[model samples]
Target: MAKTNSTAVAAALTNNQIKRTVDRLAALKAQIANLETEADNLVDLLKYQGKGVYFGNAHKFMVTTVTGKRLDSALAQSFLTPAQLLKCMKTTSTTSGRLYAL
Candidate 1:
């Protein structure tokens, strides 16, 4: 099928117009993802260069290195039986939502 070229910004858009707009939105999102990925690599390079504050023409950025000890859940589970692990485990509920396009 062909494509629609209705770049209308009214609330009363036709079905095809909405579809075309969604297509444009998805394209823009893809472009943003590509840009963010590229910039993230540069940011990683800055982090590797060392943790310090940096300044641009009008902006300042900081690279910080955090040191902390994290628990190894898999290793701990190996050292503990199922009953012991269950006794030590804690449960929590969180509110979550997601949007899907199909």
Candidate 2:
């Protein structure tokens, strides 16, 4: 029934705290973008110099060529009728969010 020193409970955030949290998230996103760019560059360099698999201190980075398949809409449209094209096609709905400077 009684709380101990180790029992940590979160206090409710104020309106200002909410805004500060959002601000922190926005800054983190920017940092993440920069880090991603640097990582991509490093990966490219490693792929050029290293073999198929890269050895890190605690992890292994495997670089493999990915062959993807997708419908050639323009070519398909030329060959198939409108009704046939509609039958073959699929509508994909995806969700994403971004923060803007206002």
Clashes of each: 0, 0
Q: 1-102 in candidate 2: lDDT tens per residue?
A: 645533233246679986896798799999999999999998898888755888889998887877899878899899999999889878999987678775
Ten residues in a row with the worst lDDT in model 1? 1-10
Stretches of model 2 off by over 4 angstroms after superposition: 1-18
Task: Please give, for residues 24-78, the per-residue lDDT of candidate 1 as tens digits.
Answer: 7778788998999999998988788787998889987799978999889999999
Cα deviation of 59, candidate 1, in Å: 1.9
- The whole-model lDDT of each prediction reads 0.82, 0.82
Clashing pairs in 1: none
